[model samples]
Target: MPAQNPTGLPFDDIRHLVATMPAADQAAGDMARARQGDLLKPPGALGRLEEIAIHLATWQGKGMPSADRPMVAVFAATHGIADRGVSPYPGAVTKQMVGAFTDGKAAVNQICSAFDAGLRVFDLALDLPTPDITQDAALDERACAATIAFGMQAIAGGADVLALGEMGIGNTTIAAALCHALYGGEAEDWVGAGTGSTGEVLDRKIAAVKEAIAFHGAALSDPLEALRRVGGREVAAIAGAILAARHERVPVILDGYVVTAAAAVLHAMDASALDHCLAGHVSAEKAHGRLLEKLKLKPVLDLGMRLGEGSGAAVALGVVKAAVACHRGMGTFSEAGVSDKA
Candidate 1:
């Protein structure tokens, strides 16, 4: 029997939701592919843009896909591990950045405005940070479940596509730990200089991840337990949002490493959860490349971006829009009175 949640939504409920989420429309994808060959341009001339259109068509279940209503939700929280010097910035930066987001001053805000994307920031828990994973669980089962439920609300406004991002100091450390646990690798492979940490701070971050793994490795097989033990509220919420977006048939654009880590949690919970997701960009963070590889996703952009807060995803939205336009607006060779290959 599955354990009941304090929110009256058990983990099984989440599993069922994921399992029942709509699969991509294979017929629509095939139709898009057929149309791509008939476009006036040489076949495969647009490369990834052509593939992106097919992917969008499949996920949207429509012959002509449009990313007209993209939403960027930035989930913010503070981590108790920030006090351990994992990040150069103080934990207060999280709240300050959230304020900046609300005031439309952050980079994500600017990118969202430029792309005409709806933006919302969720302060998961600014007043209290999640407990250090090296000492104990970051969140209890109840809090974790509720945080995930909070993430599901991002799609209520009828967003056609969703982009996930995070704003939390020391969260890179949490993301590293979660990646290591879920993907099974050395702590060094996953750790990076988050917020420009170097020297002793980087060493401490790696050591903390090792300690947490040693303590919790046995129980990580259960994805929810792994999240409760080492994941932050924002991470859990991002996973929930991804699951919910897929359930709603809204495609998701995953941001940098931390956001991808949350998607990794969803992937772990159910292999099909990410079928409706796209890798927005490959972050400068080393683990991000590995995360994308593990998910077998090729990022739509690679601008050497490491900034979180969904800035990369927001920028990639332009590429997505172009892809959709190319698919829907291009004239066929016959319509253009052009000769086809003999």
Candidate 2:
């Protein structure tokens, strides 16, 4: 893994960038719609496939969209909350899985290889975990913003589309707290059996989330504050990567539950900030579908997957490529010498 470029920005700068995100290229989207109609298929016959093509066109600012350089950027980090018996696995598993990714043995690696997509793994100071959200702020304002700046580096490999995923033991607890803070739901609505927690372990996870939110209190009123207070390093980085993709006109595919928490932070800042992203899948994580619905993103797949390493997003990338291939490779009715019904 190449060293991440050094970047240290403040929250104000991140907020400003989010506030002024570029709108999608509507002209290109219109042209893509027209092109779809010209293809040898009935209008809307392809369903979400047609919509996906237009989505890429609009975000990529090109009528003929390309997924030739799809990339998956997976961020891995440790959470101090793991000390609270929130996750069945210890926090050390975060580092171990990151090694598997580097050795090309992880599920996401296989998925990216299957789709012919490039893969990048970011280890965000796995040795130095964020503070336990139930005990203290996960990160101060400066550290949170800096982590985001580092996350923006995921865009440097010239990928046209980015799929965001994360690995952090106990992060489900972190995400639950984030969602409860952002959406004002009871902690149970946001908590789930992450890492297969159940019985007493699940109860601790729920209590941890409720305690963290109550402790954070008025600080969570601002979205960024909410992120820094309860979010982990990988969460902040994913948020940065999504924002960078939007600025670069690169469409994004968001992976399951943990990844969506990052997007929720930005969406809280600006409702349209995630206009360039698509939900890669709805995971088996119980709250993932609820989170996706709140974000207004219809997923590309729903295979009961809960392994988080951007694997689902990588699989969804294949679907996106299929949509692009069908839209651009199929012959128009005129070229195919097909007759039209009056």
Instruction: TM-score each candidate.
Output: 0.95, 0.96
lDDT for residue 103 in candidate 2, whole number 0-100: 96
Per-model C-alpha RMSD: 2.6, 3.2
lDDT of 2 by residue, 109-139 (tens): 8899899999989999999988889889999
Candidate 2 runs further than 4 Å off = 1-9
lDDT by residue (tens digit), candidate 1, 1-342: 122323565665666666667778899999999999999898899999999888888888887888889899999999998998888899999999998888888899889888899998898869999988998999988788788888999898798889989999999999999988898879999999877889999999999999988888788778888888999999989998998887677888999999999998878877877888899999889888988999888999999999999999999888888888898898999798999888
- Sliding window of 10 residues with minimal summed lDDT for model 2: 1-10
Query: What value of lDDT does candidate 1 attain over all alpha carbons?
Result: 0.88
User: Candidate 2, residue 150: CA error in Å?
Assistant: 0.7
What is residue 250's positional error in candidate 1, in angstroms?
Answer: 0.9
| Each prediction's whole-model lDDT (CA) | 0.88, 0.92
